[model samples]
Target chain A: MKKLINRQPGRVGQWALGLLPFVLLIIAYLIASDARLAANANDKLLPALNSFADAIQRMAFEPSKRSGDYLLWVDTLASLQRLAMGVGISALMALAVGIANGTIPYIRATLSPLVTGLSLVPPMAMLPVLFIIFGLGELAKVMLIIIGITPFLIRDLQQRALEIPREQIIKMQTLGANSWQIITRLVWPQLMPRLIGAVRLSLGPAWLFLIAAEAIAATEGLGYRIFLVRRYLAMDVILPYVVWITLLAFAIDFMLSRYSRWRYPWFHQQGH
Target chain B: MAIIEMKNLWKEYGDQVVLERLNARVEEGEFVTVVGASGCGKTTFLKLLLGTEQPSRGEMLLDGAPLPAEPDESRGIVFQRYSVLSHLTALQNVMLGGELQNSRWLGHCVGKTRKALQKEARAMLDSVGLGQAMDKYPHELSGGMQQRLALAQALIKKPRILLLDEPFGALDPGIRADMHQLVLSLWKSQKLTVFMITHDINEGFYLGTRLWVFDKPRLDPQAPGAYGARITYDLPVGNCEKNTLTRINRSVGNTSRAINDTL
Candidate 1:
């Protein structure tokens, strides 16, 4: 029998291939924007690059007349604060609940079904309930993000914890680890990389929930600003805001991936 | 006095019995190897000895006391895979025994105690010829090297009884030979009461001071679950220097013939 080799592109070539689609997307958008502007000169659907630049300059660099704050910075800070709190709390809760459910038969029986049911309910459907209970405040918005992502995160982490080899637990037992010790030492450390991965996955839904929450009601936020400007068809501001959100999300994902690679080198190696 | 004893030990799951009416005694510091065919419950026997599983019936005693309901530091086990935590480096894995024993929670050992344990773990790794690989993770090590690391992790606890479940089953022949030497030397130096299960008959004979072969005495095609495996042959191999292979073959042959006769 002959050995089969993987004939893939080199690193630089792979990078170029990955970037090609995005480059083409930007070129397509630019051409459409140019054609629309040349036709109508006041097109709101696809504004000129200069209009987008002016919108960014005003929103980010210039202070707002009402609050004396840069709206773009203020919105970014508010959205990020909510996102961090929501994702952070959800991750910690998922870790604790997941470990308990996976390790203890009684806990798994009690909560596994509830968690599955909750994950099945579309989080957006709960937006009205959150608004009614929390009264359209930051609390409501943050809770929306948490409620949206926590169940799925919990299930993902629970399954991961359950997948831990029984031998490892038994080995820890033989090494004198008690139930709690087994969870903390053997289970928790093993679950961390997976936890980071789960958080990264939940980020997309997290942003969606946050924006949905803020779109309906909020005085200050990226979502709130975008929805507020939609009445005037401010595509310039809306487009830049979307790009900024994407950049922020990508930055978070990149950092998390790097952290896992750095902290759990063995886990990363196993994937390869 | 026997260090490990099982009287009329029987283990069953639902209607299927795995080990039946096993009565055996293992003296202290004896290297005992158990061999059997596939699905003959060799692993279940080890689990019972490790106190990871309770016998469905009968008693297991360790050092004149009833076996604990849960596994403790008195017993250390090395599995064929996942014997060591991949997240921890070799030194950290070796230190885990003392850390788990001493630390109240989260397996944290701090201050001078932690430093001393670190030193001890380093020495243990050095003993296993893994001093330089102390900073490497289990995935970075080869199969043989990982097994050595696992050995270090188990021996660090200074367990009274060390249990091995085909620890070298995944290694190549050359590595398996090296592991045999390493295990023997560790056993002798530590004076450990060792219980190992393997599918290799020669390995069972070569390493064990005593050998146990497990099989079903009676095979009923209609009701196979009606009977379970028992210790068919228990022979002393420590002093049978020249005719060890002959003895193993004869004993195994007689046991099978006896089983067939009964059937």
Candidate 2:
């Protein structure tokens, strides 16, 4: 049974993420009770979020004196922007499409050349063509990001899926699995790490690519902010976002890698 | 109901022939092992059975029907290394093929109705003496444990025919015996037909009810499969003595005896 808490090491983070909302709700109720006592009254339902927002603000603004904190905040805020767009929406789309390609041989074979061809081209080179079609908006940026990363996922995930032995698939077949079921049960579970890795690797580059993506936009975003600051020769602000990006990308890639290792420890055993 | 028949089976890779006009029948729920030297075509034969390769020349019939061109969920394979999904824990990997073959919403909705799948997975793990390591990933366990998990995963789908490609080739001596014992037990319990390929003569003799050996004359430039290309032998299963290996050594160890005499 899927217990409230998984009893396995290397899986706590994943289960916790799966169970995050309930944890947050419990914490919220506890805090609500404390505030009710402090105010000496029954708190109204639909309680305000000022406390949470205030906590975030404090964390963001608190350790400005420390350069490291400043750097962390800058990167976090930058990723927050891209995550809202790229990782949030386009990633899901790419996963849906990329995983499809990985699961089915026909799709992979048909789209491989085009996908690989697109992946090899610099993201900058494809910007103008994307702009021409989507017309200078979020659609173009997201599309470019998706196009840029989808191929990497297609290629990576296909090989990873293939790495799943032909016998495993055969075994499943003898047990009586249909194609769709096989994909969900056998293919997706195996490709989870590679897909997650592809998404993580795609993230920072998506942000960097978004810089060129947002060239048409009027304002907002660290990428745009960088271009604006660069104009005024405000290297300090620009430098922070760049450094933030590097660190954020590093951290995300690291977590993604560790998660992959944790999720599928079997792959390492054959060699070791 | 679960009989495997090969009719004039010809498997060739390019011009090389692994099996030339070979015919064999694997009876229902029979435990058959294919044994050969390093260069023999036993691996190729197993691959053909698993539908990993085309007959290049013939077809395989499963239970009176032609074997599907592609692998089916009903057909579970546990290879020496490929059986276990590298990322999932032992229980999860064991449950994976079953869930895929049985459930529709895996990794999305409930991902196999945790209770039912877990129950089955736990049962499978327990049968393999891996109840303690159900939650542990493959790498965290010893080689024997991983092989057990692999076997459990192959058995996950309750397959009528289990195809194993030297699944115990990587295990140490003791574990290899344990694995062989586990297979014999599972085979009897589940009434499954097993087809395994191994280079280990002891393993071939011990676990398998029938031994199919594919031998070829050392590379004849003119003959096909000089590069280990030929379907040379397929023998029926045999009985074992308390120390059958020692007895076989006394009989077949004459070559060594001859060398000793010369020395």
Candidate 3:
């Protein structure tokens, strides 16, 4: 008979185990904050839990004195808008370029190496160039995100599209699908879930680029807020903002995962 | 009149000849099964017929017209593996042919048309003995079931010519026999001009109205490229008595096994 209480822990225990590190991290931060405060009453590197709560309450609930807008909400909205624009544009562009690269031999032969070379170049190094050309406006910031991640995403999607079996393509042709029909009907539908998966994998680098761009030059954004508070050593504000960014990223990743699983159950079943 | 006519078909990749001086004719409603050693250009022949590959030197005619430059709706094929899309349900896979035929780019059927297509697809799945598994994905189905889905997908298009490239090579013995019966019944009912390739000698003899044996006629140690596979034996099994068929089967089986060993 199967034991109800075996040596192994159940689902709840497993979740607790998974979250144990985070709990330990918060506890360690609290302890460090207390020790630092005891040693130096003015220590700003690590702030107390109440200080974070107060900072969050102010940024989240209260309007800024100068702008009269909830700063955290405003920053989140702006950052998400930019991230969405950048990632959305990149996903579309990657689908087009990746499909071409995977399907058209001539296009693949010409563009694959170029894409590889472009991916190798550090996107941060082009920041000055982008700013010079597009100015220090939203375009430059969004373009920075695009340039940072599009090539990698394109390569990822191209590899995935290419991995589609030759037999399927031939079979599609035999099924009376023209070149256009084959691409739009057969390849596109199949690649969409994989594209979503690629975008999910790319969210980390995307956030990195978004934050770097916002940190360098931005009037309002979570990254800009964090960096701006850094001058005053406002760990209280910066840490919460960082936590907020982490939460947003997690939420986006979770939503995308659920969407793909729900919308493309067959893709999920393929063990991808 | 022949449904498919190939005259002196020679296929070569630079100096390496894969097939040479192959001439054959397949009439409508004939079940032509090709048996050959590995690397004997059985697949290349099918590819040529499907118009996926061009022969080096030959004329291939379908219904007395020159074959099309590319695969079209007139010919349908089921490969040994990766025959069904992993991202589509069995019904969706079957409906894909009609959907593509009806719609243009991004051809997603909707409303009454979609309902009609779904109905047709469900009927196709039922015909393939997969009515209960219409919603199941390819990975969720067994090997035989997946191949059945592939058959439904191929047959849904209702092509005049059906190509099967070792379609049952991967199934278990019992399932393979069932599939053979299913495919034969479908062919007879549909009057499909079937071209199949198989490694199994018994299957090749049992299923086909006509049999083709492809093998290199000569061996050259110094210049292997000088020789390529040809139709060494062409036998009509349509009117053969049972004893004669058994004798022919034994001889052909031995001949193919010998060729396979040599190759």
Candidate 4:
């Protein structure tokens, strides 16, 4: 008989194993909710599954009385817009800074220390400062997300560009590539997949900053609604919102990785 | 006139000398194979020719003019690994040299020019026996195939000087033999002035028209960096006797063992 560590799961067995924990968690939640509701029908801490469905239906299907808009879709749209602007701007900035710092000695000498210093400063500590300057609006929320993730992405990409083998750079030189040619031709293409990878890694922190900013200032956002309903301990609404955010993050990460694998097949061929 | 001339060339880093008092003249279309102990300056010598490293003192002349401080279209090089760009396909890798030279700003060519380049690159790849693998990436190719792709890439530029730094050092013996034939045919067809560094003596003799041995003539027990390697032997190949071959083999073997023992 094979030992437990030596044994490998078949495809079907692996799928069953992956779902086991989720299945068990749902069962436990049902039991706990039933017990809580049986003891007190007015319980709100662990709302029943039916109540969760009702809350989602109200937020997603029905229009809000005040704004006449579907609240769930509206909030999702607002949150996604902020996220896109912040991440898109950071990706562009990171590409410029990473390539310049990685390939050019003069730029690296001028900015490497500055980038290192900025990366070390706690981004959350800048929340109040951002609110004060950008004001309590979408710009502040988006700025917070950018501030939180850009430094990390820049450093990651800069290190990636530096990791390009010296032999390749010399080979390019021998082939008559000027400095600009090396950057545009060799470094740029090589760094694309890496940039996507860094962006994927930074998504979690970007979401954290986005939600924190929205909770503090925004009038309409997933995070804003969760905090808005929290005064009444609206776990029914809060739980669903949290789950939706998780699904969105997972979808974005999955798509980015798939896009990288599809668009840069050569980059993925070496298992990197 | 000699295509390349070196007079009392020296290379040093801080207090350590790497190569010293080297003099050589290579004519058009000569294949120079360099062999030495591991720590010797054979690679340093190649770098000087490739224009990656400038001599700390002394001069190197190409076509009776100073060698370019930076590598240019006149030179092409292949290394033991990573000679081919991983991101580009076999055809794209071969076209890159011409593209960079022609398209100054874009680093890639446009419609008509690109089509013409593609045709030429395809022919170059076919010449290197990689016609079926033109669309393949470096990672998709085997070690020998990647080296072939690299050779195609370097030769497409029609460079005057082709520098190869142990380009087949990592291949299996069977694959290496195939590469040797491919390289010799390319050399003759292109009329290229070649410089190759190799650890294997038999390979050096078989592939090179002329052979150079780099060795340190003076070594002090207290100061190893005080002296540097020099071109201790310069011999013509093809007419060598077995007696001379054995002598060179024994000396190279002893030098390698001595260097390895110290490490």
The candidate maximizing TM-score is 4
Please give, for residues B11-51, the per-residue lDDT of candidate 2 as tens digits: 77777666666677878878888765554567777777777
Model 1 ranges off by over 4 Å: A1-7, A10-12, B221-224, B238-263
How many clashing residue pairs, candidate 4? Answer: 0
Decreasing DockQ order of the candidates: 4, 1, 3, 2
Can you write out model 1's per-residue Cα lDDT over A1-272, one digit (the tens) per residue?
44457567799999999999999998999999999888998889998888999999999999998889999999999999999999998998999999999898999999999999998988888889988999978899989888999998899989999999988888898888889998988889999999999999999999999998889999989999999999999999999999999999999999999999998898999972
Q: Predictions ranked by TM-score, top down? A: 4, 1, 3, 2
Model 2: per-residue Cα lDDT at residue B62: 88
lDDT of 2 at B57: 64
User: In model 3 chain B, where is the ten-residue run with the lowest total lDDT?
Assistant: B251-260
Residues A1-272 of candidate 2: C-alpha lDDT, one tens digit per residue: 77868665457787878799988986987687667656864343323345444534543466646354643356356435654566556556556666667678798778767777867888678878988988866677666666666567667766777667765666556656678777776777666766776777677667667666665552345566566656756443555456556776687778877877776555434452
Higher-lDDT candidate of 1 and 3? 1
Worst 10 residues of 2 chain B by lDDT: B251-260
RMSD of each: 3.5, 13.4, 3.5, 1.3
Q: What DockQ does each prediction reach against the true complex?
A: 0.77, 0.35, 0.70, 0.84
All candidates' lDDT scores?
Answer: 0.89, 0.67, 0.88, 0.91
If you superpose only chain B onto the true chain B, what TM-score does each candidate give?
0.90, 0.83, 0.91, 0.96
User: Between candidates 1 and 4, which one is better according to lDDT?
Assistant: 4
Q: By the lDDT metric, which is better: model 2 or model 4? A: 4
Q: Please list all clashing residue pairs in model 1, or write none if there are none.
A: none
Candidate 3 Cα outliers beyond 4 Å, as residue runs: A1-13, B111-116, B220-226, B238-263
- The complex in candidate 2 yields a DockQ of 0.35
Candidate with the greatest DockQ versus the true structure: 4
